[model samples]
Target: MTVIVQPTGVSAADVIAVARGDAQVEISPAAVEAMATSRAIVDGIEASGRPVYGVSTGFGALANTSIAPERRAELQHALIRSHAAGIGAPMPREVVRAMMLLRVRSLALGRSGVRPVLAQGLVDLLNHDLTPWVPEHGSLGASGDLAPLAHCAIVLLGEGWVLGKDGSRLSAAEALRTAGLQPLELAAKEGLALINGTDGMLGMLLLAIADASHLFAMADVTTALAIEAMLGSERPFLPELHSIRPHPGQAASAANIHRLLQDSAIMDSHRDDLAHAVQDAYSMRCAPQVAGAARDTLDFVSVVAGRELVSVVDNPVVLPDGRVESTGNFHGAPLGFAADYLAIAASEVGAIAERRVDRLLDVTRSRDLPPFLSPDAGVNSGLMIAQYTAAGIVAENRRLASPASVDSLPTSGMQEDHVSMGWAAAKKLRIVLDNLTSLLAVELLSAVRGLQLRAPLAPSPAGRAAVAAVTPFAGGPGPDVFLAPVLESARAVVSGPELRAAIEEAVGQLR
Candidate 1:
């Protein structure tokens, strides 16, 4: 697939296609023209000998220093080299690709005053599947992921490391040579434009939104199976119950769980027992409320991602009126706050899911289900340890949910006094979502086992399909086997697309 990068902006879908899939990226003709127009403005400024913040002068704390005309290109090169000081492990290939793609998108918008060749250089890297070796650390998230983007920018100059298509690390110059491309010379303002943006944090946020969206749907599916396994009432998921509150997410989640519970044989077997089953505990009944709130938070995060997709986040932006002015649009507070907010919401989703797992494994709370869903209770040990794992993950997620955006430290001689720890937020949010996936997987394993112990009673079609999907992971209602493999297998299934597709096939797409 080829994703055309436009001068106006790209969509979240475009970002995903190029970032996650093997989609090639192309700069639209209009974008090239826009870059040309902006390039002319920059050239004029250079000719006029104006001391622009990034063009003829030094950057950050050294903004007051002026550079001679002959030394301007050197200044740009030096900026990329000196700033490429990131530490720690290399960022994932997908993250580097996404950051590279977004940098091109920003530069091609004609606001950063870079030549068409500069943007094309980044596009070439993506088209050839060459990912720059951006390190995991060194971004404070304000002044826009400087060190991280600097590492990416240096690759365009053919002076850094790049991971080749085969995941082999090669020098950027060698990679560019093999791909029949040449290193781009850093032009005035071009190097700063390349490195000064929220691409790193923003890319991570976009990917998280995509992953979180799927997990949210999976959370709904898991909630349905858990309810059925617990022999809980489906009345709480009724459309009428959510109508008065009318949070779109709550309604959607309630509707999805309600649909999954339709014609449930397990639920029907105890339909007349409602008088005795007054409530099924908050974990079972409030699934939608918790997961629904998380869904809504994800929606808001998506909205933020959409806005950032179109934002021209750079310092010293070139205006249509032919004026060059510095701006603070590069600040990452928006992305940081969004990432943290989603983390908190996602943490709660995992928290509630763990609670459900606890309920399913508890002898007292599991209705009449065998202890730990094991046929041979004491000898089997069953899924008892799975709940402990979920609890541990939930606890870690709680710690990870402590918003990274709130803390700030001064940098660049305090010129960057209050930085947005957005990159940290995005990074931790990724971890939280991953933990949430495993946490939910444990819940899924326990619930499916509980459904297995329910036996001849049968489950809803969706529940039955879910159980069938996970059956490959382990045996049904048996004495404990090597559970690590079982839990790992369940995690694989939960993290993949097959389980979701199977359930949606039986019950239609989840909300």
Candidate 2:
């Protein structure tokens, strides 16, 4: 699939397509014309010798320094070269691709006053799968991911490094030549436009939102499995129980759990045992409330990401009337706040999941289930260490959930004081989500094992499907045999589409 960059904006779906799907990209004719129009205005301003911020003067704390016409081109080159000072390991391929695509999207809006060819340079890189070697560190997220974006921009000028189509690292110059493309020569305001935006953090936020959305649905699925495995009542998920509070996500989650446990033989077994089944633990009973709150956080984060998609995040934006004015559109506060909030929400979900995993392993709390769900107690440590792993991950998630946006430090000689730290927020959020995936995987596997222990009484279709999906890799109930591989396999199944497909096949579509 090809995503056409419009002057208006690109959709979040398109961003994901190009970022993760390796979809082709193109600049629309309207966007090209817009770039040309904006370029002409920049040319006029340069000819007028008005000493514009980026066009005629230096950047950041050096904004007061004036430059002669002969040195302006050198100034732009020096800007990219000096700012491309990011240090640390190279970022992931998908993240680099998203940053490149987003930068092109901002340039295509024609608000940054770059010629059409500059935007085309980025598009060509995306199309050729030549991702710039952006580092993990750098960017206070106030100057709009300057260092990381500069690493990307330097590749446009063929001075930095890039990951080639085959995943081989190569100099940007060699990679461009191999891809049959020429290096870009920046004109006035082009260099500054390239690096001055919230593209990096925004891109991460967009990808995080997409991942969190999927994980939220998967959370509901796993929560239902845990409820059934523990022989917990589905009465808590009744529609009447949630209609009073009426959080859309809460209602949807309750409905999903209710539907998943519809024909459960285990549920039926305890249907009349109101005395013993009067209530389950908070982790089992309040599943919807916690998962639902995470869902609500995702919705709010999506709204912020949606707005960022349409935003032109360059400094000194060009107006329709041809005036270039400096602005704070590059600030990453919005994205930082959203990413941090989602991390907290995801952490709580994983925390509750870990608690459920603990409950399933405890002989006292798990009803008739064996200790750690072992066939022979004290001989096999069946899933005993799994809860420890989940607990450790949840602890790490709690630490990572600390909001990076709330902390700031001065940069650019205090010209960029009070930065957003949004890049840190995004980076930690990515780790948090990855940890959550593994944490949920543990809960899913343990719960499935618990359900299997309830012999003769089969799980609901959805629950059985989940068990079947993991059985191939994780195997059925048995003595512990290299438990790490089983947990890893379960993690893959939980994070992949196969489990979702299997579950949905058994019980229509999930919420």
Candidate 3:
């Protein structure tokens, strides 16, 4: 199915589908009409001899210089070539596709005074599975991901390299020929229109939001496993206790844990027993608080992302009244701030999960589970070092949590004095989440094995289902053997969709 781009509205889901799912994209008729109006103004501005910021004059530190009409076309090409200054590893194919899709959608809003052919050119590349070789660095993120977007812009002009569908390399010109498509020649304002936006940062932001949402849901599931396996009482998760605080996320998380632990033999087994402790540790008892805060943070991030989705983020935006005006909407502070905040929240979530894993490893702390969950204790030394691995990752997350948005370095001859560093924050957020995925899996693998050791004691129905989901990947309890592969498999299960479905099969969809 095609994702239709409108003049001022595009949904995040649609962007993801087009970028990651290879869905086709098209500009709506209204958007096409809007572009026609904006383009006419740009043409008039060129002919009237009134220089626009990007149409007939120079850029950045050179904005004071004006050029003649004959060299105006060359000016656009020069902007792309000079600004394609990114340096670092090439971005993943998905991120590159997202950058292209977002730029096209922003252009479709008709605020950038671009021709319909320019927007069509981007869609053509996407539909043909031609991904520009965008590098990972060089975006100040204050000037709308300038350097990174320039690389993508050059590909459209058929001067740069691209990665084809089959993973082979080809110059954009060669790839265009193979696909029976022609390269685009930049027009009056098309160069700046194509490159001036927060699309690169915003695209990664959208993808991060999606991944964090999934991990938040899984946090509830993993916490449930840890609780049942460690014999942690479910009293702390009672709906009555959480209703008073009334943070939406806290209430939801509490309710999810409550539902997930329903019909549990584990809780019932210790119900009347006096020997069992009255409370679980903070990580086990306050699962709702830590993970719930992350949930709430995600809500804020989504709001920010949604606003950016419909924003016209170019400098010199073409207005509804046919006026060209330079605006600060191109600054990526909003995205940078959101990305940093979410990264911090995700780091905390991983930190708490690591604490839970530590508790499940110590035999005495685990309330009678075998040491390190090794079948033979001393001889096996099972999951003992696994806890260390989780500790190491959690430690790294703490370092990565230092917000990237707060740091700034001047660029463009100090004409641009401060930058958002949003792209760096985004890059770290992706890594932190990946580490968190594995951390969650490590805790979950320990929990699954610990639960199995209490066999015939049976877990909550939801906990039982969670164990079932990971058991195939992590295997049933036994002496330590090939632990890495099992944990790796468990990591895959945690990051994938099946684990949620497996748990939901027994309980309803997690909150």
- Taking all chains together, the TM-score of candidate 1 against the true structure is 0.98
Clashes found in each candidate (C-alpha, N, C closer than 3 A): 0, 0, 0
**C-alpha lDDT of residue 234 in model 2:** 92
lDDT of 3: 0.87
lDDT per residue for candidate 2 within 52-154, as digits (tens), equals 9999999999999998888888899999999999888888888988998899999999898999999999999899888899888888898789999999999
Model 2 spans > 4 angstroms off: 164-168
Candidate 1 residue runs with Cα over 4 Å from true position: 164-168
For candidate 3, what is the TM-score?
0.98
Determine which window of 10 residues in candidate 3 has minimal summed lDDT: 161-170
| Model 3: how far residue 449 lies from native, Å | 0.5
Q: Order the candidate numbers by TM-score, best to worst.
A: 2, 1, 3
Per-residue CA lDDT of candidate 3, range 1-511, in tens? 8889888767889878987798998889998998888898888888899878888889988888898899888999999998898887788888888889899888888888889999998889889888888878889888889988999889888888887556656788888898899888988889998889899999999989999999988888888888888888878988899888988898888888878877878768887889888878999889999888999999999999999998889998988787889888888899999999999999999999999999998877998888888778777788888888999999999999999999999988888898888888888888989999999999788888888888888887777777778777667767667878888888888899987987888888888
Model 2 — TM-score against the truth? 0.98
lDDT of 1 by residue, 389-412 (tens): 888999999999999999999999
RMSD (Å) per prediction: 1.2, 1.1, 1.3
| Candidate 1 lDDT | 0.90
In what order do the candidates fall by lDDT, top score first? Answer: 2, 1, 3
